[model samples]
Target: MRQSACINTLIRRRDNASEPKITDSISPKEASPTLSRLGFLVALGFLRLTSVLPLRLLHWIGGGLGWLFAVIPNRSAATTRRNIAACFPALSSAEQESLARQSLKGMVCTGLEMGKAWILPIEGTLAQVTEVEGLAALQAAAKAGEGVILLAPHLGNWEIFGYFVCEGIASNFMYQPPKNPQMDALLRGVRAKSGIQLAPTNRKGVAILLGALQKGELVGVLPDQVPTDEGGVYADFFGESAFTMTLTSRLAQRGTPRVFCGFAQRLPKGKGFKVIVHEADAGIYDKDLGASAAAINRSVERCVRLAPEQYQWEYKRFRRQPDDSEFY
Candidate 1:
């Protein structure tokens, strides 16, 4: 568990309302004809049934699925291998294979956990958090009437982490809709029930985040994502050039909100999750955009190091390389 000093100096500069006055609201998308489709209905029912199972059972099932992923000739396993090999070249072939297998298993576990996240009662979901670390930064930001930017990377169970923040803090988050309209609606309905505002992952979302920060509200962002070409810059990630999102850095330039990186650690044997929060490295606030982006990557890297297998290696994070090389 790592922590950074309080950002009291930045918080002191705020001269605004005693509390954030957010005007924007996101209404959950209602059930439409699309959800009545057979596939969507079946999937919804299956997830609902899965939600009631004990965490340990769900994890056990996930482990079997992970075994299948590692043994089967699948795109996910292939991509995981490629990303892990590129990021950790020093690892021996045997080590890389082991990591890739474990990563696939973690991915399966994350999928199984989604049922608990979306279908369980808010109280029941929050109860799953056995411990929390570095919450004082959130408290200090609130006390000083300054906003907070919670940077939750794609490590451990990010969905759980988002819900945890919404339960405790007044937060707004940027979301990307899933390709399936039915699934997208389901997510919106489930997440909106917690009263956390969500905006599309676009310019409008950025504006909402800015407004939230200006009024001293908490804003959440997944800083490890790859932004569109116009919104990102090339930066060194794990000694390789990765196109990283700049929105976090741009918001950091605002110099008001206290930025923190957080994640939900999946405890072994399904004991529960532990929420860990840490202050962003100072370099993320640097005027140099590239340096700031690299610093952001470094912060995420540190979190990943805690549990490499829990990170989402299946994602094509290094897909858009600086030289346009097809790494995946």
Candidate 2:
């Protein structure tokens, strides 16, 4: 974790570095196919109205929405069922179906809760983190002036987790901007309110993240994302060869930054959330890129196991396979 003289100089420069603005990243030439300015405003207004509701009530509404997803024919429900079945083959058919239904419900709850995560005041939203586990690791890293690569999977309420983590450290999160300019602007404005810097998913963004790490700051990455062929390698995820991002592995190898995987687990009854953190598997730092990617998936699996139903099953995580076969 020791820093070189050059790194120290970069640390000093970071204090005065101007972060990339989200507005500047948007391309005016690109048009949003689904949403207009008026439509975006209406959606924003609805989200703002829902932001004031109690968390418990939001969960209740989400449960109803989830039930609808389970009973109705939809792509999300199908995907959830397929993922659960493939990942948990040991489970009986009945058990897998039950888990899929619950997962659908949890996914709906995640969507409804985003209003609180994005529209509510930062302090108010963080107040819902009733407990935190394994924070000492992150604190120790920060205290020793070491950069950290935090791998946050698509678990319960990741938006809330991002805000909570950035509150205590100079953190940067890499995000893919929405196609809709208006929506992207709104999301950027809310996320930046907590002082977390945003980096796009491009070369410049990668450089920004590298700079942050050199400065001994934390950078967050969604480890489960499916990267382009050149950016990732096929790795074992849930016993299947899934295309996984190697960005975390590459970043971890660059410096002595401690790599950790974490998530905010949603408690039952909309009680609150629990922030959990754990050091990543040792293989994450392997010199072999494929081995490193496998370790990244292993880390994500560990976090998902903490709350299986809360994991995002609707995503086609195993769509790309080693043999170029159709998975979903």
Candidate 3:
């Protein structure tokens, strides 16, 4: 009880004292609501119900509800549908719709697995790494002793991607602060326990990442996330000028040899997932910022295709636009 009080006091102090940074000006007041709190509650309820009935049965129930949501034509869903349609014009309407539904089901399953990640062992969690397609390239990079960067985008099981590295490569990952300090602490505890050292997504975190690279350790990052006003440049992503994070291109350009990408694809029939690691097409760094950003978007799209269901399309990805003059 006393320990809890001390921790709470520390959290309150930190919350009130957090300062803004040049890259991301997210203040304590502007932090998004933590999904972990609600996830925990949902997990708690799931456990209680599962204790009486079969776990598989409840999962099916969640899956069914997930599928139902897949078909709903709300505004946001429509926007996502339209975005996918424009991006992958090759796909027919029925195929795009199918992908959308599959993506929603993947999100629901991902939601249910949140609590599991908190408690599951790296061995069990990584059972989903079905195939390491081009692991030789990653292994080659790791052996070079110059520190490699593993770009894990939101396209698939991003959470699982970090764990795979920590368990298999003993690498470090960067994550931002959660809005709710309590929830952040809970997840930080889980991530640390899983063997991946977690760094804040602020200036200090950048230093830590650099130091890790210097020590010949891999640094995993999700570059598709929106960059802060000052930290990123507005680049065309999927035909929309989204503020793209220039960090990925910069690192790879600065001689982080052996940059590779990977994601955990959600599988069918309520089964497990598949992990796909591939070499990003070489053109993502073609001289100009605009070209490099386009390359980054293309690379993201390729990975997103492997497991479209796990991609979180619900995010306001294209929320902000750059003024006539752009800054990256």
Clashes per model (N, Cα, C within 3 A): 0, 0, 3
Q: What Cα-based lDDT does every candidate model obtain?
A: 0.77, 0.81, 0.62
Write the number of the candidate with greater TM-score, choosing between 1 and 3: 1
Candidate 2 lDDT tens digits, 1-328: 1111111222334323333452256453422232245456665675787688888898898788789999999888899999999999999999999999889888877777777777888998898799899978887896677999988888888888878876878888887765446767877888778888889889999999999999999999988878887999988988888898888888998889999989899998778999999999999999999999999999999999889999989889998888788877
Candidate 3, residues 1-328, lDDT tens digits: the string is: 0011112333454444433452156543344333334444444454334334432443576578666666666543565665667566788999988877766665555555543445465566676555556666776667777677787887655676667655656577777654555556666776776778777778888878777777777788776787777666677666677778777666666655556777766555545556677877576556666566667777787887666666777555676666544221
Best-first order by lDDT = 2, 1, 3
User: For model 3, which pairs clash?
Assistant: 232-328, 233-327, 233-328
Residue pairs with backbone atoms closer than 3 Å in model 2 (clashes)? none
For model 1, state the Cα shift of residue 64 in Å: 1.0
Error of 1 at 68 (Å): 0.8
**What CA RMSD would candidate 2 show?**
10.2
**CA RMSD per model (angstroms):** 12.1, 10.2, 8.8
State how far residue 324 of model 1 sits from its true place (Å). Answer: 1.4
The positional error of residue 324 in candidate 2, measured at the CA in angstroms, is: 1.3
